[model samples]
Target: MARQVISPGWKVVIGSGIGISFGAAPIFTSGFALLTSAMAHEYGWNQTEVAQAATIVLSATMIAYLFCAWPLDRLGSRRFAATSIALFAISLVVLSQVGPSLSQFYLAAALFGFVGAGTNVVSYAKAISRWFDRKRGLALGLAASAQAGGSFIVPLAAHGIITRYGWSAALLSFAAFEIVVCLPLVAWLVKDSPPADASVPDSGSRPQIAEPEVAEADIGAAEIVRSATFWKLALCFAAIGMSFYAIAPNTMYILTRRGDVTAADVAWIQAIGAIAALFGRILVGLLLDRLHARVVGILTVLLMATSMLINGTATGVATMAAASILMGFAIGGEADLMPYLAGRYFGTRSVSKVFSWLLFAFCIGAAAGPVAFVRLSTLSDSVVTPLLLLSALQIVPVALFLSLGRYRTAPEPAFNLAAAPS
Candidate 1:
């Protein structure tokens, strides 16, 4: 029997991609960055304070990642994703009501973070893992690319809305879009994996299909906590996360303030970054399928470091856009590579929890990065110092990933294609 070139299961990848693309966009750092200037001007808040609100949002998401992982494992992803989108929309609406009081802004941010995990990569990864075993990397690459897809467009649109209507209106518009667009797409299309008893199409030759070697014993959360690999992964992610958070919140502001770029110009540059990120996810996904993830991870980080150096010395649009592309690639690589590593090393059985722990570490760094950049930039009176530091920090993850042990490939199992369902 000739195996189907495309599995019906690819729908899961598409659905999850759409879900994450639309759902994660508005609450994402890029979206928040669009509001930063407006909020600061209207409320007399500093850049640091605006970024602190973003930190709170991420911090809340981090906490949610910890508690929700187990529940997700037990309850399945469909309802959680749907409900989270709903709650996320509500959070946006509430945030749109922010006044001069900084306390209210923080409170809304905390709420957004609390409900934000459902729309995160963690939730979608769980669903995608169940669908494809051999083509997991590409599937995840396609799904994770949705983030960049959304980031590409959301910031541009949000900036336009903020410039014309007001920040409050921009928030309200995003909330409405989330409800009208993402909610229905997720509800109608997204679902958990098909039943194990079902005949799923595995990519292979007509005579034989390679079945993945399933582990007999599932890895538990406690074992992961005790392992040296886990700590290293966590620490590496934390550093990268901090760098991302710091840069994302400041990208437009830095360009506008230092490079003399206007909001419209910044919007177009950000869209280019999003495109770079989209390609990065696709490239990383393809590379992970063929090469050891550690090798790919190291190379990707080095590329990011190069971008950071460019960004630090950027003098105009040409240089800044080049830097943004590199930054986007780095961000996209992190999103795809980490989850792929978790599934490969830890076993899909515990990927949700394992990746969540890693995400928590990332959040800690993310929370710290913005504040640190703000302080450092304030003290130095230039953004270049902070950019260079972030570039330097990429080396930490590169070193850690480089030191990782080679993956112990499972023995491939022989299959009788006639006996198996096509």
Candidate 2:
């Protein structure tokens, strides 16, 4: 099958639209960090408590992924996704209304976790993969770039709002975006299966997506696992998540504490990162199908290494901004790669569950990376040297991906075995 242009397919278009806006969602990392300032000023909370709050948010998201993981595939992408975004919106509203208690923080974090988990980095890619067959790689990447896209615009919006109306108003504004933009887009664009499937009601009689040049014969979940392809993908992504999570989970705090950056400045830097990712996701998506997917992984790992190193040695605004942009590219490239490769290789059979299980590795990394940086920083009174050393640690995973390349096997097609047509 030929690569489809970015415009076709309701699932791809709408999912991508929702995705690009996701940067500004409530409980975003920037907001989580700013919450520290809010708490400190409003109620005199310490950094440890604030950091604990961020961890709670991450934990909630991890737990929610486990809770909703399977029904996701069974529920179909649209329903699973729309409901989740709405729940996220609601959670944000709740969070914005805290009344002097940390328990309230935990409760709001838990709800945000439940609703927001599936709307994250990978699930949107899976949604596009479910509906499109040909050019699945490009489609998933373009759609997933929404996160980078969101990362770009949302931070600025966060900065503007938090800087002006306060974090409370900022949360409310993002909550509004989730309810108005993301929820409705999901409702309109997504379907349960290929257009040809008999159960896809009111789908307007669209034909199944054209099967591309690549056959699905060996790309199903069962086949993928039997082949070395599955482990290779997982191994690369595990390392990939570790590299990014190391930077993202506590980016604001680190910049503020070590670099003496204001939240507003971090927001601007992150916005620039988002712009870099926009091009990166779009270009990488195009490349994955034309070139070997392994190439994408290799380049992403390399760029991450450079970005981390630049970050380690930098002391000024210029160096930090450069690091953010490079990191953004690496981040966007994989944003497109993870779902695109999985769909291309595994054929979207059990994609949600499989992707979820794989993404749990990100959760583990998310949990560890920030704590690692924080601990190292405390031990040495800062994170600079440790961050630089982490740049070297990233090479281990790149080697792991190289091993993955050696074990690569072609995959077969997958079909639903359990569902009854609606």
Candidate 3:
């Protein structure tokens, strides 16, 4: 009998998963509603004002991604992640201590964005890309799913804390979790590349899938920025980030506006969406391994558009729940798609730099979405108009993805699980 051997790439996957689970994107995005509600109630700020906090975080994140790309490529993933996670914890502490001043809240949000930038998918994706080629989609999906996993847990836990102790306590609790748990795991498990000896698998165990040799010429940042494909991808993802952040973070407010739903109901609905996202990412990952990414992306965007339409027209909790499932599934697919596409089109030579610019586009949309949604809601005095507009915006990504053509680099040969050693 032979012992089953696991790839060290899987260790980085596990570590990346844990780090991303507590990363800024998941924590800030998932906890937005609770924080907004608490601050709005305490400070008498309006929806638009609280939404600005999200905007600030995204704006700062955009700047961070632009500047951090070079260092990320230079310093390696583990060091960059450990330092960023530590600072992110401090940002949470700063957030927990904010007073009645809205500026203080914005300041804290800025810190979270700037310092916590490395914790986002960009850092982990670079490491993962170096480690796996054949299973990159599945590997990325598994790791990225942690963002959805965090989304699932944060609301339930934060809501409970905010309900009992307050939003401050919730912030403190998350900060402590980052330091006490996430930081250590990342330092130990996350590696930029596999060990030299570990590159080859045990012949008696499982054969290792080697990283694919990319034949495409490496496109520098200046060249990539000028390419039509880059802009297309940028535009596509910006729309995605906008539509998703606009709706996901505001689910509580959106539903409660109907006068029939309670906070608890919204929480459960979001939880359901998070669960859907978890499966959605993995499923998209599997599909990507077998199908064209453009086809998968277009279909996923259409599904999201449908969810937005359903949500806008929903009159009951049941209808909203159904919309959530579609929304969650689409959101999961997008999460997996971003890095997968970046790696596929750009190759890994300067993936960190390329992905940073792409993520910056996403940040622009994410920063604007919440604020734009609120302003539209104010003008129309209804969630319907803003949501419908979001649905319409999905067309941009669909069209752009259709035009993305083929992968610039060749994909590794498909892995056959059936032929693996027992």
RMSD of each candidate?
Answer: 3.1, 6.2, 3.3
**How do the residues 273-325 of candidate 1 rate in per-residue lDDT, one tens digit apiece?**
88898999988888877888888888888878898888788879988899888
Q: In candidate 2, how many Å is residue 182 off?
A: 2.0
- Regions of candidate 2 where Cα sits further than 4 Å from its true position: 1-11, 23-27, 197-232, 257-260, 405-422
In order, what lDDT does every prediction score? 0.78, 0.65, 0.84
* Best first by lDDT, ranked: 3, 1, 2
Of the two candidates 1 and 2, the one with more favorable TM-score, higher being better, is 1
lDDT for 112 in candidate 2 is: 73
Query: What is the lDDT, from 0 to 100, of the residue 253 in candidate 2?
Result: 62
Q: After superposition, how far is residue 42 of candidate 3 from its true place, in Å?
A: 1.7
lDDT value, residue 194 of candidate 2: 51
- Where does the lowest 10-residue lDDT sum fall in candidate 2? 197-206
Candidate 1, TM-score vs. the true structure? 0.92
Alpha-carbon runs more than 4 Å astray in model 3: 1-5, 200-217, 414-422
RMSD of candidate 1 to the truth, in angstroms, is: 3.1
